[model samples]
Target: MSAGAPGGGSLDPVPEPTGGIEADVRRLAEYIGGTERRLAALPPVPDRAPHDRDRAVAVHVRARRARRAFLARHTETVYGVLTDGLTRPVRLADLVYEAADRFPGLVPTRAQMAAERRFVQAEKEGREIDQGIFCGAVLRSPTAGRHLVETMLRPTPRARTLLDGFRTEGRIELDTVYLERRGVAGHIEFRNAARLNAEDDRLIADLETAVDLVLLDDVIKVGVLRGGTVDHPKYRGRRVFSAGVNLTDLRDGRISFVEFLLGRELGYVNKMLRGLLTAPSPGDGRERSVGKPWIGAVDTFAIGGGMQLLLVLDHVIAEENAYLSLPAAEEGIVPGLGNLRLTRLTGARLARQVVLGGRRIAATEPEARYVCDTVVPAEDMDGAVDRAVEALRAPAVSANRHMLTVAEEPLDLYRAYLAEFAVVQAERTYAPDVLAKVERRWQERERRRAARGSVR
Candidate 1:
């Protein structure tokens, strides 16, 4: 939705302008520190089968070799990149030049050297990030089939104690009331499992929640829901909205479980934000500014879309013991949401490594510094999220929306992200090898899910 008319003097009411870049930077720094500490605090994740270090190394080497071969064949035309005034890009060129610059001891063949040079040039002249505007939204998925919307409301002593047990970025309000509805009347309770998911619905069913938050004039949040019922699903023809589910558990092999983590279920988040912005609240009839929300919860296999969902949100709360794997590259699948968020938030180099490498990036690992927000103790995750939610709620809505604009829009990151998706689709449709790998991966995942008793 559009803001309250451009020249309306409404912007100052929001804290966006007040925070400035320094404020944003400070916030980012705190968040990053939190992320690092969280990772450091976690217990080590259990290793999976075929987890042999040597074998994994061999696979990586093979992948690198393939990449070099590909470069050898096509370096001059597409790979040589150019950047402006960036030392990293320039240094890359020097490396390539040294490797090939008519030196006697150069290991790579002339063709390979030429490819490296091209890639370096492209890197030098690549896209730049400008502190432009950023905007986006969070979506929550509803239960499908026989399942319905459920929520926990009102804090219980046990819930409060559990919430107070951790160090978190937000406030913790335990047990609030949990409510749910099907085709009939809805129910609300204070039980922990107020929001529950049956094992069987973890596969395909594909229920979704969508919201659309934008930063045109300022941040505007709108949400639309289709699948799950609400706490009071009867507010102004809609139920008075309450915070949705705080997903925690999931069976390992369910693809839908991964899909849910990716926040694919919340595909409608953007849509919802849009709707909210379109509606007007009776204020002083003066202009108003808004900011986006920071949200996160525990995710177990936030691979694909699940990871992307995290990218969209400014803050994330991940369980240290949880498995976070992304095999998009291995499967020749383009990481749509994940790449978009990573590139914008983390930058090109790290984002490329994470996306192109197409391997798992563990939160506890040194290399995971750039990707994760906080690697928290698994049992303490619910408490941590509670605090995170509380802190996020403390911010004025206007300021949140404005910052969202800054995060989402700067450097035209989203534009490039959309471009990547186009590239992926073209490859899938035209590149037989890539298409085959993607299809194979899809089928393999399906098989694994079935073996794990997934209905898919």
Candidate 2:
């Protein structure tokens, strides 16, 4: 289970740094190369016996630990070499393979390419790179995640396809997200009706593309995020807002940290907050994002990621019966950025109830008033969204918004928070006992459903 130098000396948490960047990188590269050989020596993961697989995983964990720790210290130097010092900035999807090819043991392909996805900006290769693993590994270094975030802020190629035709067609409909321009307001509807509008690998790329269209479209002055109608029996014919990040996907190992978590946050989610950037910004971060106001219309419920989405909105309209909660307690993972951003909206105590205690805050509750700008009957959501959009779309609103963002949450503050999240959330995602607990909770829920069915 030990990942150490040859002949059995455990690699220290951080390999010693040699005098120059070249020597340090060389030593670390050699250390990383050893991890690759050790990984190759292990039994193949899929066919291994249970015990063998467990030991293999342990070995891989050690290898990843050493690699991530080394990379954290030498992130700039390592990435500079990997990507040719920005001459050939590798897209996130190609980063790991490039590392594996160049350094051989820097980042293992098996460890990085586990999760999957699609879309223009997010996925280039088969199975969207498990950026959750890749970015999560290096994001603890301040610049790596920030650089990726800034990179993602630039328009995706698909955004150009949609934006070029945006005024002509007035709408771009994708498999998981739909964006349409209505007057000065743009509505981006979450379209995974069959899945209660929960986020997954497939939704991330499409959602960001939709976000990009809204940001890039000159005709649209404001943005609105609402869920589409769902096929679920309970919410049939009704927009359910969102069911959160798909718990089934997370439990089934389908959620990627990069796509689901960071991609969601840094991609469209952050874009929702920071607005669109026309170029990659390396200096004077203040002048980078050209943002517009956004409104969230919550219909039936907003849970976990759905609830996290509300924190970024300039205004929120919720149906009287709608409820929002972050079920981090149940999922045994961070509820995206809830811990970092929720308290700003709901205050510390109430935010803790939603995040830690998993309390569902109904729209009708007095406390819920702070989270949502307006709570009306389900029938009033449209009018509420219209009024909110009209008010937000004014020219003065943009400047005032920048003022608010500057005073409230500075860009670097958000970046620092995500840096912490990048590391902690990754640990939560791959922690051994966490998934077992999640599976057991799922089993218990299924048992309760079965018992209820038998009783009826």
Highest lDDT, which number?
A: 2
Per-residue lDDT of candidate 1, residues 4-106 (tens digit): 2221111112112123433433433333233223322333222422333233333223323333332233222211221121111222223223323322111
Instruction: For each candidate in the order shown, give its overall lDDT on alpha carbons.
Output: 0.33, 0.73
Model 1's lDDT to the true fold? 0.33
What's each prediction's TM-score? 0.39, 0.85
> Candidate 2 — which residues are off by over 4 angstroms?
1-15, 19-30, 36-54, 82-91, 110-145, 281-288, 441-456
Q: Give the least accurate 10-residue stretch of model 1, judged by summed lDDT.
A: 130-139
Tens-digit lDDT string for candidate 2 (165-219): 8779998889999889999999999999999998888888898898888887889
RMSD of each: 23.9, 4.9
**Per-candidate count of clashing residue pairs (backbone under 3 Å):** 76, 1
Highest TM-score among the candidates is held by which one? 2
TM-score for candidate 1: 0.39
